[model samples]
Target: MLIARWIFDIDTIDGRSAADVQGAAPAVVLDESVRVVPGRDGEALAFDGRAQAVIPAAPQLVLSQVFGFALAFFVNVTAPPDGEWRGLLYKPVGENDARGVGMWLYPDAMRVRGQVFTAKGPDYVDSRTSLRVGEWTHVAFVADADGMYLYIDGRLDVGVPLEHEVVPPYGPIYLGGQPDRPGFTGLLDDLRVYASALDAGTVQALARPPS
Candidate 1:
């Protein structure tokens, strides 16, 4: 089940709260840098490559201490200009590590990175797929006992197995951008996070625009 879904359809902003259409959690608009822009479905949050909105790691937003998790969103990239990694959705993987187990955009590919503490084994895994610019694209990432998967526009493009034990992350989830990386220079809409890994069919269905 999805603990929260931020559709960003409403323009109402009471203080720092950004309502979650799924009726679970509200993201605190950090620094008031993000704005609500008319998006693919209705409305979306726009980050100016500076600020980010964050949903705190409340009990409801935290996933179970398991490897199963999934995230999906609709994005339209207007300009990436630089090759700097831009975060789409992220959760701090470790306190010491600068990177996280989350989705990031490269110059041409979108990557999902994750790692587990280990002296040996498949502790680090990543999935990547090329991305198209100037249009709305549906992206999805799933990590579970089966491994990590990345989907673009609902199409399964990358999948890898988790060969070692990995602890789940309980840190706050950031959308639009991460702490160290640049915010997305575009619009984001219909963001969702599920506690369980979704199958290919389910992910494809989710990619369909609201009708």
Candidate 2:
């Protein structure tokens, strides 16, 4: 089931925050540079690697065994410098780890990565193909009883075996950026979080452009 979604269609409460279309919680903008721009859907939020937002911790926002998230992104320019990992969505458990699940763009390797951090350590899968700069692309991360999967443009890019059940971190959800790391340099739209793992059909539906 869909637990939370953000379209950034409009700004409210004096433009200091963006409401989650699902009514879960508001994403409070941390920097004034975060702007509402035309998006893949109705409207999108633009992050300049310094703009970010925070959604307070909530029980319904955490995902465990079977869960998934999808979002549309458009890079503003060429990928970041090699070896630079830019944050997309992050929930840091402690100061050093993204304890629950995190999504990032690793332009250094020209790939995207999805991670699930268990008690033992973090396990991740990288997309087999490189990301296209300045193009809107749909990306998702899903985990089920079998393992974790990463999707690009509604297709399964790769999957990794699960060694342990996910251990969700007790932390606020960070959008666009996380602490001590650079933010995403692009436009983001239609971010959705689900309580259950999504199938290929559902992912494809999410990836499809409005006709």
Candidate 3:
């Protein structure tokens, strides 16, 4: 059984929000199963959990100064047509703007995909690789001023070079499903986000179960 060392204790220095910030000591108590761990070598947040649920206020509530995010989850499929497993990183956009990037796992493959629409319309792109079913796979994205790289189990599968310079604003970042399209389903565990690029050593540390 997995135990949460620190669920929603705001008194600790690593607490999730201002209400829960270290010293404020809010009375928040997360569901018994969810745990947040400090990232290995950087100032990042990571979560470990057992079910498919959303951290609704993830962006504004939890993340600050985050430039890159990654999610690793288990795909439990007892039968055919296994559900669509996707992880998204989103920040607020103006009503007229349509641009962001996400990584997804379809039944056949996994993809590094994104969309951009200034005022003309929406443009989209994707790079996919075949993936195994009903297994726990590590999917990660590292984004900076240069562009984004999609990784599977710590190895680069596809690189989406930016046509123009791209930078992630310090707004709320989301995971698990598209903000616009909710209810796409899967089991996500060990989700993480960082303010800086996670190096190989850090990624390996994150991949390991907490001690």
Candidate with best TM-score: 2
lDDT (Cα, tens digit) per residue for candidate 3, span 1-95 = 01111122223323333122322223222333333433322122232212222333233332112344333332322122334444434433332
Tens-digit per-residue lDDT, 64-157, candidate 1: 3264778888888767447677767776644434334566676445444444332233355455555566688888877777567778888887
Ranking by lDDT: 2, 1, 3
Model 1 earns a TM-score of 0.84
Each candidate structure's TM-score, on Cα atoms with residue i matched to residue i, is 0.84, 0.88, 0.52
- Model 1 stretches astray by more than 4 angstroms: 64-67, 94-100, 107-128
TM-score pick, better of 1 and 3: 1
Tens digits of lDDT, candidate 2, 103-139: 8877575578888787688888888977777878888
Off by over 4 Å in 3: 1-99, 106-128, 167-183, 208-211
lDDT of 2: 0.72
What C-alpha lDDT do the candidate models reach, one value each? 0.69, 0.72, 0.39
